[model samples]
Target: MIKIVVDLLGADKPQTELVLGAIRAISENKDLYVYLMGRKAELEDFLANVTYDESQLEIVDCTQEITNYDDPVDAYHDKTDSSLIKGLKMCRMNEDIGGFVTCGATGVVLISSILILGKLNATRPALSVVLNGRNDKPFCIVDCGANIDCKADRFVDFARLGVAYMKTLGIENPTVATLSNGIEAGKGSDVIKEAHELLEKCGFNFTGNIEGKEVLDGNADVVVCDGFAGNVLLKSIEGTAKVVFDDIRRAAAGASDTQKAQLEAFIGRLEPKFDYNNEGGAILLGVKKPVVKGHGAATDKTVYNTVKIAYGLAKNNLVEKISEEFEKK
Candidate 1:
């Protein structure tokens, strides 16, 4: 059986909703055994009301939870019993535990992952998320808001991490590219220029630099960038997609019935591609174990998807594969 630890605190959504997601996950995957860490009485009450296999679920009693208001560093040091901290600790202590899933504060998750799980050969962990590109193929971007000021060498590390992740998704010999202002090799800053050269000789299928617009065009299977640029790029794409979709919705509201039907059909087909709930969550690669960070506003459906991803990565031995790749360096 594949075991996963899920922290049910520190999200914008209520605990009950996240718990429901976990229940859904276990119901779907009979081989999955989830350790749900959160308030004990509440969790018990909620579970009692639901009909699920008792063997697949275990609730760890946690009195405290890490919140956005708490300093991530201080919370890590102080909130040892918090759901996020305890859940990760559980993952570390148990070899059978495949991975961890949490809709917790990103800062705390990143810190706890490094401090608790440690890194794969001490390489920096990059947060990566898969997105459906314009060409209808899925692509992943590394360092999406973790390690904001990465050095040039770190970009290369991100590329390897991204490649390792994509390979697990069955993308053999995935093409890689650096996110920059222009497609030219000299388009970005000194870091990009230097990293560009390193990536060329890194032995992966490097496709040179890709502009922000080219990212959605699926120019590369993996796009590498510092956290600052990556985070901005991710949010920009989300924001743009939201604005455009909202405008279409407004226009459809007043359109003829036939036009409305066509617009609704278009949105139904396109929206899931950009939805965070469906994409599961961002995977924190480079850690010793798979750590999935769900969006703060995640729903039960999001939790289910995130747990599925964590389970899949753990089953695939993502950490060991990544370590093997880095050992070649």
Candidate 2:
């Protein structure tokens, strides 16, 4: 059985949401075991409202709840009983535990995972967000919000990690590209230019420089960038999708019945391909164990999908594969 530690008190929604999600996951997989960590009484109260098999779910008592405003590093130092910290400790204590999933502050989750679990090799753990492409393939953008300033070597490591993830997801030779202003070889800032050069010689299937406009054009399998640039690009894509959909809705509001139907269909077809919440926040790669940092406002469905992702990572031995790649380097 696979044991997963969940931060039951982490989300902004009612505790019932987490409870329902856990119950749903448990019902889906009979062999999966859940160790729900949070205040005992609150968890128990939530449990009282649901009817689930007692054998599949177990509650781990933790009194303190990590708030959104709390500094991540400070919370790790001060709140020893914080659910996020406690969940990581639980994973460390038990070799049987396969992964840890948390729908809390991203900063706190990253700090706690590093502090408790440490890095897999000498490489720093990076936050990798999966972006959906046009060809039904998901490309990973490393350092999505982790290390803002990165060196060429770090970007190379991100390539290896991204390739490993692609393999785990059944993509054999994932194409890599460096994000830049133009597709030309010498088109980016000093950092990107250096990264592009290094990637060309790195023995991976690199496709050269990719511009922001062509990110979702299915041109590259993995797009590498510094956290600052990656974050800006991610936000821009999401923001543009929102604006386009909002305008579509407004235009459809005053259309004739037939035109409104067509507009609605178009809007439905153009909706953002990737659901960030549905896939959890992002995977913290280059760690010894699988750790997922979920969005603070994630709903129960998002939390459940994160658990599935963690399970897949553990089952595929993703971190171990990354270790092997680093050793080869």
How do all models score by TM-score?
Answer: 0.97, 0.93
- Top-TM-score structure, candidate number: 1
Q: Write the per-residue lDDT of candidate 1 for residues 48-114, one digit (tens) a residue.
A: 8899999998999998989888888898899999999999999999999999999898888999899
lDDT of 2 by residue, 41-149 (tens): 8778877878788898788888788878889889999888878888898898898888888888888888888989888877888888777877666788877878899
**Distance (Å) between predicted and true CA of 2, model 2?**
2.0
* Candidate 1 lDDT score at position 94: 94
User: Which ranges of candidate 1 are over 4 A from the true structure?
Assistant: none
Q: Which 10-residue window of candidate 1 scores lowest in summed lDDT? A: 271-280
lDDT of each: 0.90, 0.81
Backbone clashes (count) for model 1: 0
